[model samples]
Target: MSSAAAAVSAKPANSRSRVLLASLVGTTIEFYDFYVYATAAVLVFPHLFFPTGNETTALLSSFAVFGAAMVARPLGAVFFGHLGDRMGRKTTLVAALLTMGIATFLIGLLPTYAVAGWLAPALLVILRLAQGFALGGEWSGAALVATENAPQGKRALFGTFPQLGAPIGFIIANGLFLIIAALLPSDDPSRPSLAFLDWGWRIPFLFSAVMVIIGLWVRLNLVESNAFEKTVKTGQVRKVPLVTAFQNNFRELVLGTFYMLATYVLFYLMTTFSLSYGRAAIDAAVPGLGYDYTTFVLMMIIGVVFFGIFTLVSGPWADRFGRRKTLIWVTLAIALFGLCWVPMLAEGLVGVMAWLIIGFTLMGLTFGPMGALLPELFPANVRYTGSGISYNVSSILGAALAPFVAVALWSAGDGSPFWVGVYLTAMAVITLIALLLGRETRDIDIEE
Candidate 1:
């Protein structure tokens, strides 16, 4: 090997710290920017953006706008994935973070339905699409950078650094909301009272700037991935990794997308749908726990803490058991766990806590190995393009419509959670089948 090539091959002492810190911090900001919207969609958007005064239509419309981001995610994946593969993962990662940060901050500045009429929602959709697109390439790139930098035989455990972002982001986002909600309490159920919709909620959205700055500082100091570095030195980088992924890696894309559906389904249902249902008016046509808003959020805080912890724990589990094997049992556990939705929800707050604990635990397990499993499925040349696109594309199948569909099912069953549980079960079953079909690549060499 040439001196430059040898330098690229020889891992630096600081590379692991740079990789893990960048992955964890960058993705935490990314998902933090993403999830604050999910929380708003359930708590504030219907009144602020839609303002129809009719419950179901307004809620559905809010979630539809929420789903709009997911629709744009695949396109973002294609664009950013191409950039990451061709140019470099660091460039794409930086760009994606900037796009997300700027867009989220702007959401704090948006005019409400009362102020701008139809233009309000139009602008919201546009900004949300921007967030989804930037996020498309962000996650897979973070995963690739971390796993690629890992020592042999520990990729899954190392990859958890990026995966840790999801729960960390979840906790931070909800925790921020709780803090804001404490400072500005709103008691109206039909509406959030102007105080919250007006300025309180924007605190979290505008706070994206600080998070972005911290993430950027960490990422900018980072070393680039060894895989991409090696690919560059070897002159193997695809001219357009997006096109190359389509031509050769389509199967991995499809299976990987399906394999992650259960994770998405469980997440949205537990977090977003639960928030909406738990605080919904008990007498309404849709089923709900009707817990006080503050109380339900407290339950969520507890759930999210467990979510964050298990995410870290699942990493070593994946490392020891093999990614595929761990995922298979975990996915199956998720499928069976879905059956508990009825009794669990029926048990009220305790049941809700139990339900959330189980779902988030399974979520951490199923998702922890994904950062390793996804990029490992692709060749180094197109790994970023293939893995990023597949991962984001799955959002449409899994998260995009999950809350909307869950509410629709609840309405269908006259406030029953029966059909919603069925939906969760089915998504989990699909993920299990995909796991069974996918090749075990835990021992596969990522460099090739």
Candidate 2:
């Protein structure tokens, strides 16, 4: 090889700190942006964006808009996935972060239903779609970056750093809201102060711009992964990665999508549905746990602390075992946890807290390994497109509808959460079956 070619080939891998930080920070910002919207969808949007005469109708409408974003995620995967495969993970990641940050920042500035009439909701949905679009590309790229650069036998452990972003983001997003709400104290604990409903919620959304800036700085410093560089050197980069992904790896696409089904459902149920269910008034048409919003969020934050801890723990377990085996045991536990939702949720504060802790712990286990597993399903040339499509498509199947379905089931059961638990169990079964049908990805050669 020419001296110049040799130098290019022999370049050292990204420093471990740089790889982990780039992956972790970008997803932290992305999930922070997403969780901010989720918290608002429950606490603020129904009151402002969809001011229907009835509370249930208003909440459902708000959730509908929240779910609408999932529809855009797959399209985002294709668009940004193509770019990641064709250009580089670094540039595509920057674009996704900017897109999500701008959308979230804009959400803070939007007029409410009273001021903008129908235009208010229209703008909200538009921005939500943009958020979904940006996120579609974000997770898969971050996963690829981490796992692709991972030291031998430690890919799953490296993968957990990115997965750590979800819990960290949830904590930060909800923590800001809690602080803001405290500042704008309410006369009645049951209802938000008018000032808070009017303005306090926007701070978290606006604050996302600062995070986006940091994420961009970290990502811009990232050199393309050695694996991706090899694809380029070997002339293996596909001109149309999305098409090639589907044509060549159709089975993996299907399996990966369903493989994530339980994790997505459990996560949204734990975070979004639980927030609404926990905080709704006891005397309302559909009674709930009757805790105030601030109290319930605090409880969730406590549970998410376990979520973060278990996320770190899961990586080593998956590495020691295999991803499929670790996830199988975790997935089974998730199914059993679903069955316990009703009894646990009915037992009042202790029960509810136990449920949250257990559920989020399982969420951590299932989610952490995916940062390695999904990227391992495809070769370097099409890994971005294939994995992005699977992850986002599962978002559509699992997350997009989980809150909506749980709400419907909650109402269907006359405020009982039994049916919602059943729904979770059902999704878990699908995921377990998918896991059983698929091969262990722990040993796969992702660079090929």
Candidate 3:
């Protein structure tokens, strides 16, 4: 190639690399900040915040608070989506980083129930809502930044770059928790490590400041997405992206919401619900595996390692095979995997390990292509708004209630995991139907 041609090509290629890097870094922090709460909810919040309840009640209440974030995610979607579609992905994402950073760091500084009583949980709810709001705009912008800047025919591969942040975030958050959990010592008949609950947990939330600073540095260096730039150049940027998305892109919006359901439901069931199930005291009023916290969390981290690897692999497969086809098949695998939940968890730690590996592998396969598929469903003018709405709406429909619902389902089944498995399979089927009926996004011109 001529020097001039190579230079021009190299510019976009380099920009795409930066977009992917920024997306990975920013989303890693976003999810790390977010999942730190999920981890804490299971590990400490019940004991620290809701001291008034039985173990069952305390765990349920913490999950209730955890789920509350999903309630506000759609609102964040609207607010940030508007800013993203109106202003630009870069500015909106940077703002999201700052908002999440400030909120999460504040969470570390909050007093526990012993010091502040009911006020502690109340403040936690407020901060969790803020995290939801920040994430509302973060995912769409990151996905669009990566996918829109992607080279032709490789949108799925590029899109998965941002999705990789999920597993990476999971690893970091869980690894830190595990390390800190180890420092505090385990509960024993003679002496217990109340330190983990007393103050050790706060260390994770407090550390979010560092993650935010790093994320902001990377995001600040990023340019606006090429798709948004072209929309601006064409003078076709919508005056009201949210409204335009609803009016013009309703079908794709709906399809994208259902398309995400399988991923969200399976994710929480694997990560959050399983933690509760595994860590419960077997002889307690409510039955659980009674595993140690650090061990179970370490297992979860190992499973997430596989989750991270498959996320990268799914990108290339989605690019080659098409998003709809990949989703339908991988979701079927999820359904099959769901049916094995009872048998696997029944196997003790080994079974639990098997279940998580299978569940997370399937989660990666279904989740990876979303960054490309969601954005491709909308026009550039409202892509942020449409994808944000659909993605967070799915959160409400899927994850917001998953742990709470799974617990309820487990209770309703008389302590069996059967009903939860049915629920997962049902969600996968719904997602499969959504994919079959939705647009074949792989061939869609992103520039459209």
How would the candidate models be sorted by lDDT, starting from the highest? 2, 1, 3
Runs in model 3 deviating more than 4 A are 1-14, 189-192
lDDT of 3 by residue, 89-112 (tens): 878999988998899999988899
Candidate-wise lDDT, in order: 0.86, 0.92, 0.85
Residue runs of model 2 more than 4 Å from their true location after superposition: 1-12
Could you give candidate 1's per-residue lDDT for residues 124-213 as a string of tens digits?
999999999999989988998888889988999889889999888988998898888878777665446568878899999999999999
Which pairs clash inside model 1? none
User: Candidate 2: how large is its RMSD?
Assistant: 1.9
**Model 3 poorest 10 in a row by lDDT:** 1-10
Query: What's the TM for model 1?
Result: 0.96
Candidate 2, 311-380: lDDT as tens digits: 9999989888999999999999999998988789878889989998999999999999999999999999
User: Each model's number of backbone clashes?
Assistant: 0, 0, 0
RMSD of each: 2.1, 1.9, 4.0
